[model samples]
Target: MTAPEPAEPPAAEPGVTAAEPAAAGPDSAARPGAEPAEPTDADAASHSAALPGADLDGADLDGADLDGADLDGAEPAGALPTERAAAGVPGKRGRRRVAPAPEPAPVLDDAELRGALEAILLVVDEPVSELTLAQVLEQPAERIGPALDRIAAGYTAAGHGFELRRAAGGWRLYTRPEYATYVERFVLDGQSVRLTQAALETLAVIAYKQPVTRSRISAIRGVNCDGVIRTLVSRGLVEECGTEADSGAFLYRTTTLFLEKLGLNSVADLPPLAPFLPDDVEELADATR
Candidate 1:
């Protein structure tokens, strides 16, 4: 068996060149007389609109008017005033301007301050604290102390019927010691008026152990002192200071009236409790002092 001869090459049609390839379709690259079609503005715009952030290096965009383009997702150049303020942006006109707080009143001179202090003192029935005076006078406590000392000295030098005295952790005016006899005669008027023994004892305990509670006073006296304490309070001898920290009970202290009656300038001037106490209990007086 012999191999069939290779099939004869297809015959070239008439009027067709043999060296040229077959005619290509309209979409083919090698078609004769075919120039790549230049994209129109409409086509370019449609392509750009389809792909976001697409490169358009060779695209002709001159006739592609973007006036009607949808740019809803684009960031604006500046934020609105309310938005800027909410975001706390610096150097923005939307920021609030806060007005400064008012300053306190100016301090008065020594003479004015003294006069103001005297006016307040004259009206107050109870002894006034240095701190209270300072607050009302709008001056420092240090300055108030000096002014008070000056006032006290002036009263003493002038031999006023009343003297400024510090007592019960405060300052108050009291009749001079020399005038006490006359005051007592006028007030008593031959009436037999005196504190009971129990009241006297309760007052002594309060004078020594100030800021003591009724419960503690009862324990010290070995008897319930509630009645006696009430009597002393009514007589203007003892007064409630504040509550105790641990026990939360009302604490009492002696008043200026107690000092005047005892002829004592302050609680510190009271005679030593050690001498009157038993030998074994004398050491406890040191704690009270």
Candidate 2:
């Protein structure tokens, strides 16, 4: 029998090229019928790995019309909350930024120190400690202490109407005792100088019997003195001392303001009450009997 020659492939169109068949494996091509080999890691990855334009997060982009992601390696405008935390937000970069401390004030000369201390003293409502003054003025504690002493000494030497005094563990400005009459007249502004009689009595009781309970004070006075005691306390004349051991009542005592008002060094300076009492002790005893 004569052998027939194989027919050639059909001609491609003018602009259209013929599609090429996929190259089969060498063994598969050699064998008449063979199953194809399984896809490799590289082949599986190529399916996802080389998408037209893909991001590190595995999200893709087809064109400019693609939605909700930055083309460059930047955070998208609409990011998930979990992603926003690390999305280059200013001042929230997962690290603390501590502001630098303010610089200390320049050291002051003697005249400058005195002026500064006087300025602070004028504005102060209560006694300010030396440590506080040193911190505020940025001077050494030793220097501040001696400077304060010198300032006090200068006031005393000059016989100024006001003196720098240390009391209650701190320094304060005070009107000298001799000049207090003028200061009182100025501050009173037509108000009376005397404390109320009840207040005076409560104060006297507290001064004489220091750390006495309110009940004991009432017992001695034969009246309810809660209001008077409160008034004395409000006036800074009396303050709470330790509570009574047995009764557990808050005990009252005189204050620094009280001593200052009376110009006394301590409660011991309070005059003896017996000397000021009425002289007819025998008649009073006879009447009581």
Candidate 3:
């Protein structure tokens, strides 16, 4: 009696069982208060497809504010703008725009071009070539020739004192030939200046044997002509042309002014030296020249 069986272990509560875990099932992990499961690949892909620009691979939209974009099947906000696409920047699929070629320089009209040519010709000292004038005026060479022709015609029609002529292989301004008498008289001023005997001889030698060197002239005259040549040069009768190829000495020649004073068009107009020299000397002088 005193060691009667210990009271039977208290019975579990009516709704409770032995302390054991419940059987796990698919729904067990998805209880009402439980955290949701991570999405599967299929579900993630479908969701992404529903978002704008999701199909555009490598598109970056981190800084974009897409609030204004249409959410119902509209183009992606991540696409390049149409303007940028058309400018040949990669992507967005548009015709590339090309800048128009630079417009050609406007051609000047005849009157305007001729006026410019006249202005340039007035200030130039040496003859100006057609190519040079074309470069300066920014006109075509063909146009320059026609413009020069018109300018020359206008000057002629106006009877201007100066005329444009092609000389020394280029265009230059020259006093009309008809005005030469008046020009000569004005230059000489009714004074008869004469060259000394030595200067005259030197000038004659230089005229016939043009482009001759001082040493050659000395050899021919049997005396030094350096002084006489200097005198002639100072009088504007002769000028240094270039060096003799064989002697490397300075070569002298008569000048345009010299022809002007002699009333000749060119050196070829000089009279023959036959009458002024002995028969033998004449042949020798002609042969020397």
Candidate 2 global TM-score: 0.52
Poorest stretch of ten by lDDT in candidate 2: 88-97
Candidate ranking (lDDT, best to worst): 1, 2, 3
- What is candidate 2's local distance difference test score? 0.79
Task: Give a tens-digit lDDT track for model 3, residues 50-147.
Answer: 89875745657799776545444334456566745554453323233566999976788877887788888888876678999888877899888777
lDDT agreement with native, every candidate:
0.80, 0.79, 0.76
Best-matching candidate per lDDT: 1
> What tens-digit string does per-residue lDDT give for candidate 2 at 164-250?
877655788888889878888899988986888988888898899998999989987879999999988888889998888897899
User: By TM-score, highest first, what's the ranking?
Assistant: 2, 1, 3
- Where model 1 places Cα greater than 4 Å from the true spot, the runs are 1-93, 185-193, 209-230, 233-269, 275-289
Q: What's the true lDDT of residue 121 in model 2?
A: 91
Task: Tell me each candidate's TM-score.
Answer: 0.51, 0.52, 0.46
Q: Write the per-residue lDDT of candidate 1 for residues 115-182, one digit (tens) a residue.
A: 98788878878777899988876778898888989999999999899988786567777888899899
